[model samples]
Target: MELFFFQLLNGLGLGVIYFLLSVGLTITFGLLNFVNFAHGAFYMVGAYVTFVIVSLTGNFWLALLIAPLVIGTLAIALEQSVVKFSYVLEHKYQILVTLGVALMLQELVIMIWGPIGKNVSPPSSLAGIIEIGDFIYPKYRAFVIAFSALIAIVVWWGLEKTKFGALVRAGSENAQMVGLLGVNITRLFSITFGLGGLLAGLAGVLAAPLRGADPFMGVEALGIAFIVVVIGGMGSFLGALVGGLVVGVMQSVMSSVWPEGASLMVYAAMAAVILSRPRGLFGRA
Candidate 1:
């Protein structure tokens, strides 16, 4: 029972990270009708940036603040220069071009930081364990769960309640109609992309200490993220949240009980979900 509880906490933490990146992909795809394979690259960059900031300033808070801003600003530039043009092309072109961009970004990371990975230790304040009667839990892991839950709530509120959120939703449903209604869709896309990068960047920052700041970490995340997106419903925000948690818990349990079968279990769960629901568990039909 103790093990199960711990796994649940770990799953929640992992789910949040997955949620962060998938949400952006969901919005970008659902709204702009563009395929962005490079989103994971931004996530990788965020971890590296967080590592650098933590090394220089020795301040976790500062790293959190700066990492998202830097990545988001870069995303703004990326959208303006290339992503903007890709919208006119087919999804295949968008995927191919974005994959190229992802490779370029990965290489750029290697050149700047060399061929090794970096690690950022959790803040001094968050280190160690907390005793809860019979079970002791890591404080950092708890923070991961709480932080992710807060972010999920904020994203949900923004999309469901705010005026701008309504605009984004309308555009996603029918961009031509939204644009004709005087909503600036191009600008909105740019903003959404940047915000998406911000979320990915924040994920990087959070995952840095857990997974270490590796150049290839983004590559690792991409697979799981794609699965979560598929299982949760490709364009559904709530789907991403539930899917992430489901995948995370499944991975955690499988890894514990059948380490050798861990990787296969992830795909098995995804396959099961897909087989059961072709449009996704929460996606529109």
Candidate 2:
């Protein structure tokens, strides 16, 4: 029972990170009707940026602050320069262009950082374990959970309360109408794309301390993000949150119950969800 509880907590922590990863993808889709296959590359670059900052400054906190901004700017630039052109194209062309962009960024990372993975130590303040009777947990993991939950709340509030959020929601429903009303839909699309990149970058920075920064990690993260999106329903914020938690808890618990099949179980859960609700848990039919 103790082990189960421990795994469950770990899973919750992981779920939030997954939420951070996929929310941007979903939001971009929701607002722009565009899918960014290069999002994982943006994530990968964020991790690498963290690695560089921490290595030079020995300050994990600084990396946390700057890396996301860097990736967000880069994403905005990409959108303005190249990605925007593909928006009017079919989904297949969008996929191809973004996939090409992803490949280019991946190679750029390899060229600059080399193929070797680098470990990021948790900040000195969080570099310890918490003990409560027989239960033990990493301090950093706890921080991740608390911090990510805070972010989730802020994001939810922003989306629910802000005028920008209103525009995004309205744009998703009828972008042409929003444009007709003088919303500057192009600028909004750029901002939305940037926001998505920022979130993915944040997720990468948080995850670096846990999994280390690797060139190929983005590919893996991308796959997991897509799975979360599929399970939760594309373009649904609530779905991203619930799907992340479900996937995270299942994977974490399965690691203890069936170590070798943990990865397989993730797919199994997704399959089950799809069989029952093809539109996803919170997605609109």
For each candidate, what is the lDDT? Answer: 0.88, 0.93
Root mean square deviation (Cα) for candidate 2: 0.8
Give the residue spans of candidate 1 off by over 4 A.
Answer: none
Indicate the residue-level lDDT of 263 in model 2.
Answer: 90
lDDT of 1 by residue, 108-204 (tens): 9999998799989899999999898999999988888898899899999999999978988888889999999888888999998998889989999
Which ranges of candidate 2 are over 4 A from the true structure?
A: none
Span of 10 residues, lowest total lDDT, candidate 2: 105-114
Worst 10 residues of 1 by lDDT: 214-223
Quote each prediction's TM-score: 0.98, 0.98
Could you tell me the lDDT of residue 165 within candidate 2?
Answer: 90
